[model samples]
Target: MEKQVEAIVEWLRQQLKQSGAKGFVVGVSGGIDSAVVANLIKRAAPENSLGVLLPIYTKPEHMTDSQKVIEKCGIDSLTLDLTESHNVMYSYIQDQLKGKNEFNESTDQLAGANLRARLRMSALYTVATNYNYLVVGTDNAAEWYTGYFTKYGDGGVDILPIVDFTKSEVRELAKYLDVPEEVITKAPSADLWEDQTDEKEMGTTYDRIDAYLGGEEIPEKDKDIIELLHKRSAHKRDPLPQYKRKS
Candidate 1:
């Protein structure tokens, strides 16, 4: 574990030195992934790393946990409340659809949720550009594998360090790094909408995903469902399809 942490720190430093970037800019959601990344990168580039908390109607506990992580990791961060930004965009979209044929009450759930994720990404990039830092992403292997992240939203970033680690593995690493117990124990959620959670939305738990990913035996029924998720989310793991003109 020490070696793994050392390697990550080295990788982060090399990423900055090679790119001539000042440091890492991360969105600290108080989730294990974000906490781990922020801690690791700050250790690598203490003077350059910056953590930004962009809370768009975020839960109170989440904000508190995020603040705890910032203090624990000694990260330089600022809270940019995005509740109004999200509301404005959400309202604009709904109003635009009010007179259109696609108007539907059901659109609010997915539409508004994804918009929040995109808005957060936009804010991260803006800070990255201004500070000449790379926007470090926090998606773990389970989230990436299940396509649990919003396309071009949480998925949009200059660098993703935890993509190779499963959700469970992320928790273990977080513990090793002394991440707050509350952040570690909290149920994983995109928290994009009310009463939403990662396992609930994916219809599977991180334990199951980790078992399957590790090639361990599992019930046939669970295996079938896991396979389906992998197939459905294949596109998310690949480059977006593009059409090229024949030269």
Candidate 2:
């Protein structure tokens, strides 16, 4: 764990130096992935890191956790309320519907959630540009493999330090770094929508998915679920192949 941490830090430092980034701006969602990423950023570049708390109609728990993460890491941070942005976006989309119900309530809710995420990313990018800081992503290997993140939303970032670590490995690193127990143990959620949990939405928990990936003998049902998710998300994991034209 120590070696992994050291290597990651060194790599980030080199990248920052090469890119001439004055600092780093990360979107702290109060989830384990973001918390771990923020902690790592502080450890790697204490003087040049800032965590941004972008809450768009988020729950109090999410806000509380974000504060806890900021306090625990002792890194500089600011809270940006995206309520107005969310409201305006919702209103615009609602007007476009023009009394026609284009989607079910669940689909509409998901769209709103994704809008909030994209709004946060927009704010992060703006800050990054203003401060000449790189936007660090908090996505993990497991989520990336499953296309669990919103494209051009949370997926837009200049750097991703924890992309190689699985969800389980992230918890291990969090423990090693002494992240708050609540943050480490709390239910994994994007908090994009009220009462929405990642595991529930994926139809399987990270443990089962990781085990299957590690070549363990998982139940037939579990394997089916994992395979389905993998197949559906395969496009996100790979880019389109290009063919050479005859010259």
Top lDDT model: 1
- Model 1 C-alpha lDDT per residue in residues 1-247, reported as the tens digit of each score: 6777888889888888888999999999888889999999889999988999989889898889999999999999988999999998888888888868677887678988999999999999999999999999898887777778888898988877888888888888899899999999999888798778888887778899888899898888777877888889888789889999999
The stretch of ten residues in a row with the least summed lDDT in candidate 1 is 99-108
Would you list the clashing residue pairs of candidate 1? none
> At residue 44, what lDDT does model 2 achieve?
76
lDDT of 2 at 184: 92
The window of 10 residues in a row where model 2 has the poorest summed lDDT is: 98-107
User: Which segments of model 2 are wrong by more than 4 Å?
Assistant: 99-106, 240-247
Give the Å shift of residue 43 in candidate 2: 1.6
Q: What's the lDDT of the predicted structure labeled candidate 1?
A: 0.88
lDDT of 2: 0.86
Per model, state how many residue pairs clash.
0, 0
